[model samples]
Target: MQSTLYPKCVLRGLATTTAIAAIAWATPGLAQESEDPPAAGDQVAANPNAIIVTARRRSETLQNTPVAITAIQPAALEAKGTLDIGDLQGTAPNLLITQQPTGSATANISIRGIAFADVEKSFDPAVGIYVDGVYIGTSTGQYLDFFDIESIEVLRGPQGTLFGRNTIAGVISIRRTKPTMEFGAKVETTVGSFGTWGMRGVLNVPIIEGELGVKFFEFHQQTDGYMRDGFTGQRLNSSNSENFGLAVRYNPSATFDATLTLERQDQTSKPYFASAMVPGDAFCGFVPPGACGGNLTDDLYTAYKVAEHSGFYKADGVTLDMEVGLGAVTVNSITSYRDSDESFYADFGTAGLFIAQRPQTYEQFSQELRFAGDLFGGFDYVAGLYYFESDYELDQSTFVFGAPAGGIGVIGHSESYAAFLDFNWEVFQDVRLSGGGRYTKDKKEYEFPLILSDSVKKSWSKFTPKLTIDWRPTPDMMLYGTWSRGYRSGGFSGRAGTPFSAQTPYDPETVDSFELGAKTEWLNGRGTFNVAGFYTDYKNIQQSTVITADNAQGNETIVVNAAGAKIKGVEADMSFEPLDGLNFSAAVGYTDSKFNGFIIGQPITRPDATIFLQQLDYSDVDPIFAPKWTLSLNGSYTIPVGEADVTLSAGYRYLAEYDQQIAPDPALYGALLAQDFSATPFVVPQNDPRVRSDAQNLLDASISAQVPMNDSGAMANFSLFVRNLLDDRGPSFAFAVAAYPNLWHYGVPREPRFWGASAGFEF
Candidate 1:
């Protein structure tokens, strides 16, 4: 079949091109004008027009920034149908942003090879996500709805020196549409499969004509999940979410600008159904929601025994930014605060008797002051100082063996401070050299109420640096090489499999990276091409260790900093206009990542607190979700249909397979079972689907037309779109927790074929 051949062909072709992926996944969603060609929809806008960015914390053209960054304009975002942040997965090379297996309103954002799925109260994600210059404090609510967005920038590789904090791997920066003086409004709605319905609206008002303006946006979407329950006939993994935001912009004078934004999101959803290796119960109302994940019914069946209250997540935030330009120098200030709460209950067995619930709260506040200008006649410089504080709390609860063994609450707080400097020296006209450095210090404290002597405190410090050399051979072409270092803070974790009292803080992580790349333009701005090669020296890799619960059935989470690791990759992007009304774009990324040393752990300890074996050596594991290859191709053609102009676009993306978790082989799992229970000779299922998923292909297409209403410039359009045209459902994430008689494989399922139609008008 074509589906089978597609995977095989793409796997073989990945190496033939010797090309890897881009940083920060950015899906192209906006509608592009026929006159301009676009870049890879998976990579960026793909438009032939030049893009402006602030990847280095300074405004400049993307091609002139000398970084492996992709810019997604509003047009590309619309074209790609990226309504949510996680929907942008595969838009960037080597980027994987998937739903957290636990439940809704969470994300696992990875860049290159660094990633984390630890749900502990203190573990930091290697990839940092930012909205309007404000850092998202935790992974709890990073999956945001995209309503009125201006652009999104994805920076690949380590960006610590300039971006700071958890950006050891990369950064995803989102810029929302600011208020404009001109009045405007747009409303869109969609209906699709599985009882899906969506509505979105935006309004722009000129409160004071040219000096002051306000913009407002809101979005709501819901679906009746793809999976059905075998017992109660209930749905699983369904979602209902709403998001809204308001922004005000003030431009009092020519050189001064200020903006304020407020936003809120509320999401409610059911948990992913668990597939059991050993079926325990298959009846509805057999057990409460606190305990699940034991009974096996069907691959897509979910057992719902209790009242439906699975997941609830809410987030609110506010930001203020001010900028002043004085001749050749500019000063900027950013202040923001965000709060989020996540509460969820998920079934483990098809019978719905064995379930788990988690409640978490997160709050963060930050401030940054920056200055940029030309110095020493030939040097451009940017310097900044930043401060951040946050509080996080989580409770993991479960009903195991007819007992309440959960309700263990963990709370954590942290404060971070940093100072940074960056400079670009144009020493020889065409040859420019840039360097930057950041010094950061972080302090943390944690308290686990259920565990004795659980109050913990620690601190971390690091200095990251970056240097780059760029050669602009022509006005449209540049070649650059960069060497840089990145850092991620370390803190106490409560999710480890070990006893809460035995868990310790993991060490901080760091990475040294080197990149060589070229950016070029041809055919008089009709075509553009860029490629890059990178190597990373990764150290103190933080891995989540799985261990048998001393007195329970499922495995527990432990955070450990394994030895080290290495990653190398290459990527290329091309976009061009071959004919009038026709545009084609392609981008690909290939990565090679592996652990450097061993991960030794204390051997099997029983609920009686007695050791049964010595520490074992575990090493050379693959990076989680670090796919080996990522490829994207897209094309669009325009045609005149009566009095309206019509455009048809199609795109395809392939994501290579990678490990979903640090899972164990069947034999190793048996050994762990022996330590906890007297079960010997236990072997895990070899064909369990929860272990991982193979590489998969995704296809999407859209058709839209713009019909000019009158000479007054009013416009209206309609669109028909299909995402996942082939209906490929490969696991986006998988988890195999040792659940006594069965090693349960539960996860967030891949999206199935979804089609929708929409129409909107702008006035």
Candidate 2:
């Protein structure tokens, strides 16, 4: 059942009241400390809320920026022992990050109930990921591991003006630490549960004092996995990865600077085990009754698979970033190129009745140039141009009952160009008017060599605009309202089951969003509270679903403009330091999303063996992955133990239940009824329980101590941490294969409890 744990009206009221109180209780003389905070690893600033950010392409205080964004510092990330992007799942509001089963390196991210999860390169991700000013074009490599990181920012809502295409939901920007022009070295090693162990090293060298510097870093890790294979009694979800990178910084003069980076990563892992959830299925009939059931068993870490497979991923990339300061104006350029290749096999039936393998290669190149300046004493503006191109080739083969069922090969190419201009004017003494517009053009070409003799091409263009009005009635508080639009490109389905579906093309999707927000610092910057309420009109959603087809392949995945939805949500984040060395923070997100229109294609077979689609209305179906309420609470305390500082931290996160599929296919149900399948007795519900993941509660804790090695600013640190403390083994993803007599259910479970300890040194 769809869960509405928190009422929408109550959440909205709470958000509004919080914002109003923050403005009303503003104190005087508390806003003069607007200087940027010191860099990471430096001394702590007096006011914790004075952190600087570049969310608008210009340097500004977080409290002064009108956008709703969360900036996570390196220290916070380290406290929780964060490894990859997926580890930040519950750190922000209205955010969800899950590693897909296809590959451990692939991430499925959703913000404000907007997301797209697919291995196909033709489908664009709803949320945009940017690393070091370069956009990551594919989900295959989006789950980046953390090494020498500076900051991570999660921006909620549409970032249309600055970030052009595929940003209909929002953007995640990650910045890596740069060379400091001084000699330094650091090393760390970790050992943890599931036979996990890793080591990392970083070195910095100054080629010329204050002129040029270089930094090198490497990381490697391996884990024995948690899930046990029933056939071989060996681990099925093991992983091993290695990453190395180098950065060179050249600052010949104060007016101009440039930094170049090169990186490579290699990884190997066994895909997640697909646990079957039915007893009468063909494959399940061969297994014991204890292994085949209608629901997940207590021993969720065991998979009854008959075969094992391993997958590998390799990636290489390079980036160049340059900035020129001209007194009143600044010019910046960013150029990047990245490529990756991966191959993985998946057993959809866990029992090995149906198996598939996909091998893909992807490459992308992008260049961006932007200029920022003050046109007048009270006017600030930024203009930019962007160009991006990407290409990918995918080969997929399937095996049914240990027999080859042919395969399909797809090649896709995409090119995009955009121009944008954003401006802010100080209309009044304490009020500002800001507006921006971005014009983008995207062209896509796709080819299916095994199915189609000719390639297909499509083009889409959109002009997204933003308008905002902000008032800073008091120096300690700011209130703003904004309206914006976001767009995502469309293309042909690469995993189409039939030739007709392969040749068909889908249209682009868009969203219109309205938001009101407030940012405030109270009690002399000892406390901070921010709140935002938004309503988004999501249109032409690119919904992907699995359906039975009348082709050689019984089932195929298709993408369509399935539905339009109305999504309304409220988000609030607060942090307070009530004591000298203690801090507490909380983030709450409430989303009320409903589909206004839903249309699905139902397969129908004619007497002549021809297959066609009959449009059906499924407007009552719930949206997938749209959790009603998400909450996170965290606390940390620090104590000065002689010359060393000992700190302890803990966090708790809660996620309400959410659906994984739109609705069961009516045609599949009818076919099962005709066959008199006994499973029909359990599948007669309008809202299938098999397609929903229940609510989850997660707990994590860590303790660490830092000691001064000497007066020369060297430090030694040791830490211990645990995640999923309660060992909640809930399914992160679930699905139903409702193809006639092949009816069955399968799901991927979340990782179990993990405990680890680490030690590090820096000099």
246-345 per-residue lDDT for model 2 (tens digits) = 9999876565567889999999987756555664443566654545764553445677666677799998887878766555556777877777888988
Which pairs of residues have clashing backbones in candidate 2? none
List TM-score per model, in order: 0.87, 0.90
lDDT of prediction 2 = 0.79
RMSD of each: 11.0, 10.2
List residue ranges in candidate 2 displaced over 4 A. Answer: 1-49, 279-283, 286-291, 297-299, 604-614, 663-687, 738-742
lDDT tens digits, residues 154-187, model 1?
Answer: 8998898778978978999998777886698877
Question: Which candidate achieves the best TM-score against the true structure?
Answer: 2
- lDDT values, one for every candidate: 0.72, 0.79
